[model samples]
Target: MTTSLGPMAPGDIRTRAQIRQEFGGSPQGGICPSDEKKSVNLYSDPSIGEHVGYYDGWLAEEDELGPVFEYTGAGLTGDQTFDGPFGMGNRSILRHAEQGRKLRVFIRAGTIKGTATATHRYVGTFNLDQRLPYVWRKVRGENGEVRSVIVFRLRPDGAFKSSAADTIPAAKKTTVEFVQFQPITASMLNSGPATQGALSLPSQRQGAKSSARKRTTNASTEGVFVVSEAFNTEMSLRAATAASIAVRREAALTKSYRAHLEAAGHTVGAFQIRVEGLSSTLRTDLYDATSHVLYEAKGSSSREDVRMAIGQLLDYSRYVKTDAHPHEPRQAILLPAAPDPDIRVLLERHQIGLVHQLSDGQFTGPDFTAPS
Candidate 1:
């Protein structure tokens, strides 16, 4: 069977037997660990119909960072653990990420009417989200007892395509707890560092303290300021309905500009601002510490994109703490190309600076060090 199956690509559909023959794992479970290949195959069958307690599918649409597919860990009938003798399925996934094992995923299609075997569509390869690998949520077990489950956040390795039916439904209301997992790095893996600090599961008391500190910090900022890295937006099951191509382009543009700034010996990072009473956070694309400038990047130089950048820069500047810099930081718009003449005039009128990348890849803008 293995000899006849051949190799599987991103969207190939195959039965459990064929997948097992080609890869390695039990024919029955969700997590198939192949020690020989150092890979784990995760099978998600939404047809099981929520008996397992969490939906496993691609986010309805991509988020700011890009498309994310959520997959629940093993042990649906019992409490899921990260490591140890129990929950081998869950542990296999963690080790797959830590040891840099290939993580392949598939979604159940339907059965072949007469036969009992189920077929699955290969989604693509994925990597654990480096920032936050998984979140702990409670779910009802088979016997009606509440049990903890680990929901892993996965990011696609490259282009991924899936049917609309594969979109995850809105998540039910539940208390979600964040667990800190050190991102896997080549240095850490090659050196074989001890696991003590790699995974930190906060104690109940410690969790409470952490929450309290977060609230206090939010209060201190008067509801508007946070270092980008420390801010975690509340989880929303409602996936984006809009196309994500623009968002992806915007992310890429921001990343490239950030690198350009750093290469010129300037310090760069972002800021997360939360308006008072609002559940959402507004994140600035780049903050140049060397020049004390706040920049909002746009993927296109269209009027709409330029307007959005202007508004965002203005709104973000209002809440920046006075002590954050020696003086008030200047505001600017970073665009892929220069805007129209009228748009340039509008920016000048508003005392906003403009920075645009030329075809040759060099950036042109006002001297950031000069007084606004």
Candidate 2:
């Protein structure tokens, strides 16, 4: 609300961290700053089964979800409008997430000139993780950089245009535009504004009641605030695969283990096979619409390891708290065996051991009940 953005002031141009702390949150609780966002309960809440890969190890929701906004605090002075190769004007989202200042300021580019080039026929899309009603983010852009960042709160009168389009013609050589677009990490799901976003549910319900019966009933809770299930599926399955290899060479394939994790992940959200939850940097979630079971890699062969992973599974289930999908049965998979210390402990303590820290490859449990 205030201005004079030199470093970052409270209510002026607060970072994601500042907003979180101001309301009600902590730093040490979440898996990481970026991952620890509110809304989705995370690994810490004993009930949530947060895996090692997610922000706080919380499972990714598999159902259809509404828009979830992502505000970046990796401040850049100018506006590539995004965090690029260099960390210029490098503004960290939050310093001490514990202070409860873990909230990203929305972009309010409405006050400034519009750069997006939108025509009647051609319309490019920007990532609308969050559908803010009256907020805009301001950032300075160089040839391809971020600068002079500022945020403003205002109402939009239906005047939004798509920015410049990136045209990549059929390339002669393999060209991969390594744009580091941060996926809603586990931390953000567990601790970031997501939970805070939950408070809006009742109002969301009341508004739904005003609509037609079909629309009102459907609007209450089914798809009001759902995230992309497809994205969650891809990310979470990836986490399970990594854990499968880490706990043991082939723990992921054991029919019993795979079945357990398969059922558990779908219902619970994630497998709590690791203490830090799932691997943030590495993960893949797979979802079967027909079967409706989410599978996770359980590396340890010993019952103790499987039990730990089970406990983590229970954790995620508990936090979902609501019996939103009671019919769904989730699970964790622990099979095979490994020799790494982290892997061993994960198996012994949390039941997450299937993973190859150095590489993105893995094997299923001895039974080879490969994931779907």
Candidate 3:
């Protein structure tokens, strides 16, 4: 049962005007203050003169997020996807959310009536949906530019009583809640690994577009970042597998490769190292103890999957190395299935090695000659 009042419930809901008249606060935007004289911005920012926040909805004509209301932070000034912890508008909402503050929500009431006064509907008090609060969505900025914005999903406080008519409509199913984002903690922001929560593995912003990766994967909160659908059952069956399964597959592939190398009279080894002044440790998937070859593995062979694998392999090769020199290992991308000839060509163009799964359950690759 919902705590919110129905649309026609009398004295159970207030319009934006009522709150303002009773609270006797300023008419400014963003976080508005009421007669109780409490500060109510998404996040507090003394800098950038951001004492208020702009609430917005990016709903398509037929789209909805159940009874939850989603609001975007200010500052769509550029093409970069907004980061939560660093901005005045974005970071403030995150802070308020972490502190368990309920921000009032309002919608422009005169859209259909064309009223002269800026009237709004006092929807209800909403708290950040702590389960999966934020997402990166495309929005048109104040400058008429399209860019990614951090959208905070707010659910009505169970304690706040409202009439049924006032409640937002529920969606048909939870299947469409595809974009689940992890809130960036102060600790995560201070550290520099670009985490795509349920999507690809954590990476640095060197060779790959992290946002693009996130958009392509549409990962769930369960830690499985995969395509929403596959072209065929076999081709797309792995998409339904858990991300943990992918990790295990990578580990199994590494074990098989090590055994194969050992059988071929090549000594295989793994490497790990800690960098100074960084809290995160770096490790290689596999390194040839004898041949100094470094391998990075992907769970699938799609273009995006292979692309991320390339970036990871390169990043690993750059940091992890043998006693001889840095980046000295023959870099190779390991995959569970063969990619297209074009993908192989892309690898060869970069002078990187490619090893893919053979149909009979054995792996074959490094097709290009590794410099002896």
Candidate 4:
């Protein structure tokens, strides 16, 4: 339901030898005749008789030409030589190259756009010491030079401005700031149940620290199974239940389940039934360790009516102390039975997981923490 998007990442420090080798054609900033026999660095002022002219000299062409700011930034196309550091075009540009054994930086970009709109990820350097998505990517030249590019979709302050949608949809929109990352102290692999494909959570940055909302409710049903009202919240959860039941009854067979769930994104609550020899309830109810919808049983044949079975009941879980058994980290038993097929799918779509069974029962099991 909710899509998560963030800002671009920063680049790293590169050596001189790396820049010269990979750099192709003219300079990235359109300054030198990289394609010519004897390329010149036009950034030098002829009058000053030196290299590196007035740092701000290139911005004069904005009135007639734009590369300036349009809506989606679709214009401003010209030869590399036309928009170099000497011209200072409105668009943000950076140059990375090697001169002898040394490296160079061309910081020729504009200020952060006014408001947050879209988000992109860039790889480079960073200083995530803030409350918003902010990181920098070091653009690299052909060989291997570190070209700095400040990566931040939008600082928290950007929310105050009006958006391009208010205008002709042509105004430059900034990206929304989402990740204010703290340094990461752990290096752990992703190990949860696999869907069609495995998931790889973001790696922790060195020394960065941030506490995410850890989802842990391990114990399962341990009382009488109670069937609740029916709900059709999501299709995936329904699909999971149907598939699980089929698997138990030798019906839902598949090497990978993610593909099945993704392909079965047809409706919120759909129940299918078979009579004579086969049966399946194409619905979901139970949730897995990762909050994804677990499989539900297929509805039975004509002779057997579709039944919503209850597993276990817990008079209470709030008073159950997990610390009593220090070794056992995941305390699974909870008062609520696994949600019906509909709710599970909706939660799973959002990266939530569960530890309940589809059918209600007097269930019991050892609670374990989700993999690190």
Residue lDDT tens for model 1, 1-372 = 111355776667888888877777787888888877667899998856377656787654344555556788887666566445556677566556445466688888877679987888877777665434555555565467666666777776653445666665543232212222222232322333211122221111211111111111122222222222211121111123232345445555666777677677876666544344222234567777677788888778899888988888778786543344645578889888888999999999999999998888778988775323
Superposing all C-alpha atoms, what RMSD in Å does each candidate have to the true structure? 14.4, 18.7, 17.2, 24.2
lDDT of 2: 0.26
In candidate 2, where is summed lDDT lowest over 10 consecutive residues? Answer: 215-224
**Residue 136 Cα positional deviation in candidate 3, in Å, after optimal superposition:** 36
Better of 1 and 3 by lDDT: 1
Consecutive 10-residue window with the lowest summed lDDT within model 1: 206-215
TM-score, one value per model:
0.48, 0.24, 0.35, 0.16
Q: Which stretches of candidate 1 lie over 4 Å from their true place?
A: 1-6, 141-143, 171-372
List the pairs of residues colliding in candidate 1.
none
Candidate 3 per-residue lDDT, tens place, 24-139, comes to: 34565555533253324332122221122223431211112224445665553543222533354454344443333345555444422454554444544555543334545443
lDDT of model 1 at position 210: 12
- The lDDT of each candidate is 0.61, 0.26, 0.45, 0.21
RMSD of 3: 17.2
Name the candidate that leads on TM-score: 1
| Candidate 2 local lDDT, residue 30 | 24
For 185-268, candidate 2 gives per-residue lDDT tens digits of 334333342212211111111111111111111111110111122232112111133332342233224333334434544321
Better of 1 and 4 by TM-score: 1
TM-score of 2: 0.24
